[model samples]
Target: MKSSIKDVVGEMVTPFLEENHMELVDVEYVKEGSNWFLRVYVDKEGGIDIEDCGRVSEFLSAQLDERDPIPSAYFLEVSSPGAERPLKKPRDYERAVGKHVLVTVYEPVDGLKEFEGTLTSYDETGLAVAIGQKTYRIPADKVASARLAIVF
Candidate 1:
């Protein structure tokens, strides 16, 4: 059900993003307590502002109202993914090269499931992350989740 909502929301928002020169980061449909939230994350080359979010929210809200694809009531939220944005796509990984990141794999890579460090390289095969002095080669297929990491 959540996947279906995400799919429908993605379909409804793609054109809006393209038309507005924004990139769709992600779509999440999740329940929090007794409420359901449909979150739309968007970004562009320079990042997005609140006004951008508002525009997307307005457009999406109208579309959702018209289509009524969701059976239950849900709050719609459109916003930027922020500095620690998720790295979900190949392009995202490519762009994240040389940046700090946190990557988790389904299975252990070198006996470790989580690696946090600088993303040294990314390619068709996989990505290389340098954690301190040690560099680990993590297969793309093995990755369960990845996101930019803020170095404190």
Candidate 2:
């Protein structure tokens, strides 16, 4: 159900983001306590501001009102993904090269499931991350999740 909502929200926002020269980071439908929240994460080359988020929220709100894909009441939120933005696509990884990141694999790589360090490079096949003196080459298929990491 959560995945379905995310997909629907993604579909509904793609054209709006493109038209506005923005990029869709992620969409999440989650229940917190008794409230349901539909969160939309967006970004661009220079990052997003409050105005950008407001515009997206307004557009998505109207669309949701018209379609009413979700049956229950929910609050809509649009915001930047922040410094620890998730790397959700190949382009994201490629753009993340030279930045700090945390990657978790579906299975252990070198006896470990998670690696955190600087992203040295990324290509079609895999990515190389340098954790101090050691570097791990992780195949793209093995990655379960990846996101930017704050070194501090």
User: Which number leads on TM-score?
Assistant: 1
The sequence of per-residue lDDT tens digits that candidate 2 reaches over residues 121-148 is 9998899999999999999999999999
lDDT by residue for model 1 (56-136), tens: 999999999999999998888899999999998889999999999999999999999999999999998899999999999
Model 1 alpha-carbon drift over 4 Å, by segment:
none
State, as a TM-score between 0 and 1, how close model 2 is to the true structure: 0.95
Whole-model lDDT values for every prediction: 0.94, 0.95
Checking candidate 1 for backbone clashes, the offending pairs are none
| Candidate 1 weakest lDDT stretch, 10 residues | 1-10
Worst 10 residues of 2 by lDDT: 87-96
